[model samples]
Every structure is written in structure tokens, then in C-alpha cells.
Target: MKDFFVSLLFFGLTGYFIYLIVQNMPQLFTETTTIKQYGLLVYRLIMVFVLFNLGIVSSKNYKRSKPA
Candidate 1:
């Protein structure tokens, strides 16, 4: 039960961070009207994906290493 709550908290925080980045994108720069803006978004999304995958793998390994 405790692990479940912790997992939920992690997911909630990740989602909130994503939401924040998307929410203020237009106001972030003055010249975002070009394709460069989309490029930046793609880069950020890929980085986020990689980080999330690392977190998942680390969590799984942690569980596997712990003896019940």
C-alpha cells in the first residue's frame, strides 16, 4: 500500500511538470512562431522520455533486489 501511494505521487508530479512546460510554452519566447519552437519541444519531450524510462528501470531493479 505504501509503495502504491509513492508510485502514484511520482506519476502525479511527472504529469504536473509536463503540464507546466506545455502551458507556458507560447509565452516562453518571442520568436516561437518558427519551426525552431517545435524542435525545442521535441528535444524536451525526448529528454523527458529518457528520464522517465530510467526511473522505471531503476524502480523495477530496486524491487527485484529487495528480498521479501
Candidate 2:
């Protein structure tokens, strides 16, 4: 059950991140002279952080739960 919930949360966060990127496609691509580039960079950085943290946590839990 714990693993199920954790996976669900991870997927939810990832889906939300994708949604944000897709929704901002216009501002991220259309504004060649605007400052929206910074926002896109920040969003990508956040997605990387989320994916990294999820991997770290899942691995830690797997290691702890494994039998010697």
C-alpha cells in the first residue's frame, strides 16, 4: 500500500509538470525577445528536481526493504 501511494504521488507530480510545460508552450516558444525563457528554464529545473528526488527516495526504500 505504501508503495502504491508513493507511485501514485510520483505519477501525479510528473503529470502536473508535463501539463505545465505543454500549457506554456506558446509563451515558451513564441516570445523570442521576451523574458519568458527564464520561466521555461525554471520549470525544467523543477521537473529535474522532482524526478531526481523521486528516484532517490524509491531507491532508498528499496534498499532498506531488501533482505540481506
Candidate 3:
């Protein structure tokens, strides 16, 4: 149960970090409006895919604790 919760916390943080990165992208890099929009779209898609992989890893790692 503890391990499961810890993984859930990390998953949430990963998503929030992705959001923060996308929102502050304009300050990080300067580009034309059209290019910037396309770049963000690509970045979001990639990050979402990465999140899916994290889910897979978390699922594989979770083990039910046996009673003492």
C-alpha cells in the first residue's frame, strides 16, 4: 500500500511538471507563434506517451504486502 501510494505521488508530480514546463515554454524559448504552437503540441504528445510508460513501470513494480 505504501509503495503504491508513493508511485501515485510521483505520477502526479510528473504530470504537474509537464504542465509547468509547457506553460513556461514561451519564456524558455523564443519562436514565431505558429512554430511555438506546433512545438508545444509535439511536446505534449511526447510527454503524455512518457506518462503512459511510467504507469506501466509502476504497475509492474507494485507488490502486495503479505500479512506479518
Candidate 4:
């Protein structure tokens, strides 16, 4: 039960973060130079990677806490 809640919380926060980024995407792209666009692309990729790894680690820990 606790593990389920923890995973839910993590995903919920991740979703919210993504939502915020998407909501601000137009502002980020409006009249931006090529360099600035590339920078935002890289930044978004890093954020996704970090969030994916966080979910993976959280699941691993949750599994480890359970016995066979």
C-alpha cells in the first residue's frame, strides 16, 4: 500500500512538471534563435532523463523492500 502511494506521488509530480513545461513551451519557442532552441531541446531531454531514472530507482527500491 505504501509503495503504491509512493509511486503514485512520484508520477503525479512528474506529470505536473511536464504539464508546466508544455504550458510554457510556446513562450520558450517564440522568436527564439537556433542556439536558444537547441538549448531548450537539450534542457528538456535532460529533465526527461532525470525523471525517468527517478521513477526507475523508486520502483527498484520498492521492489527491494518486498520479500520473495
Candidate 5:
């Protein structure tokens, strides 16, 4: 019961964060110059990679702490 609510909150926040990122994605790609556009592209890619790894790590830790 408690665990169910906690997982629900975690997933809800993750979904909201993804929504915000998708909402701002166009602006991230809309730089005036080509170089700036590529820079933003690389920045976005790195951010995605970092976020993905962080999610994996956190989920692994959560599972470890869960009761068998």
C-alpha cells in the first residue's frame, strides 16, 4: 500500500520531467547559428545520457532496498 503510493509518486514526477523536456526540445534546437545549433545538439545528447544513467542507478538502488 505505502510502496504502491511511493512508486506512483516517483513515476509521476519522472513523467512530468520528461514532459517538460519534450516541451522545451524545439527551443533547444532553434539556435541562430549552425555552430550554436550543433552545440545545443551535443548538450542535449549528453544530458539525455546522464539522465538515463542516473535513472538506472537510482532504480537499482531502490530494488536493492526493497524487501524480498
Candidate 6:
């Protein structure tokens, strides 16, 4: 049960990060940028992906790992 809520929270975080990136998307195209800025964007995307996968794996494993 606890794992369920935690997984939901992680999913929510992933969604929120994606929302933030999308909301900022236009600004990236509207201005000049540097490699460092693009690198930061890639880093954020990787973090969002990790959070999403963590949510998926934790939910899937909880059933098998539940205490007897």
C-alpha cells in the first residue's frame, strides 16, 4: 500500500517535470543558446526518465516483494 502511493508520487513528479519542459519549449527556440543549456536540458530529460522507470519498477516489484 505504501509502495503504491510512493509510486504514484514518483509518476506525478515525472509528469510535472515534463510539463515544465513543455511550458518552456518556446523560449528555447525564440532565443540564442549554448551547448551548456542544451546539456542541462538533456540532464533534466534523463532525470524525468529515471523517475518514471523507478515508479514502474517499484509498482511491479511490490506485489512479489510484499511481506508475509
lDDT of each: 0.64, 0.68, 0.67, 0.70, 0.61, 0.83
Q: Where does candidate 4 stray beyond 4 Å?
A: 32-51
Query: Candidate 3: worst 10 consecutive residues by lDDT?
Result: 59-68
RMSD of each: 5.0, 3.5, 5.2, 3.4, 4.9, 2.4
lDDT of 4 by residue, 3-31 (tens): 65677676776776687668767766556
Candidate 3: the clashing residue pairs are: none
Tens-digit lDDT string for candidate 6 (5-64)? 888988999998898788877767446877776776787799899999999987977776
lDDT for 13 (candidate 2):
78
* Reference-based TM-score of each model: 0.57, 0.54, 0.50, 0.56, 0.54, 0.78
Clashes by residue pair, model 4 = none
Off by over 4 Å in 1: 1-20, 27-32
Q: In candidate 2, which residue ranges exceed 4 Å CA deviation?
A: 52-68
Better of 2 and 4 by TM-score: 4
RMSD of 1: 5.0
lDDT of 6 at 40: 69
Highest lDDT scorer:
6
Q: Which of candidates 3 and 5 is the stronger one according to TM-score?
A: 5
lDDT by residue (tens digit), candidate 1, 1-68: 44444555555656765876688687666754667666766766776676566557656766766779
User: Candidate 2 or 6, higher TM-score?
Assistant: 6
Better structure of 1 and 5 per TM-score: 1
Work out how many backbone clashes candidate 4 has: 0
TM-score, predicted candidate 5 vs. hidden true structure: 0.54
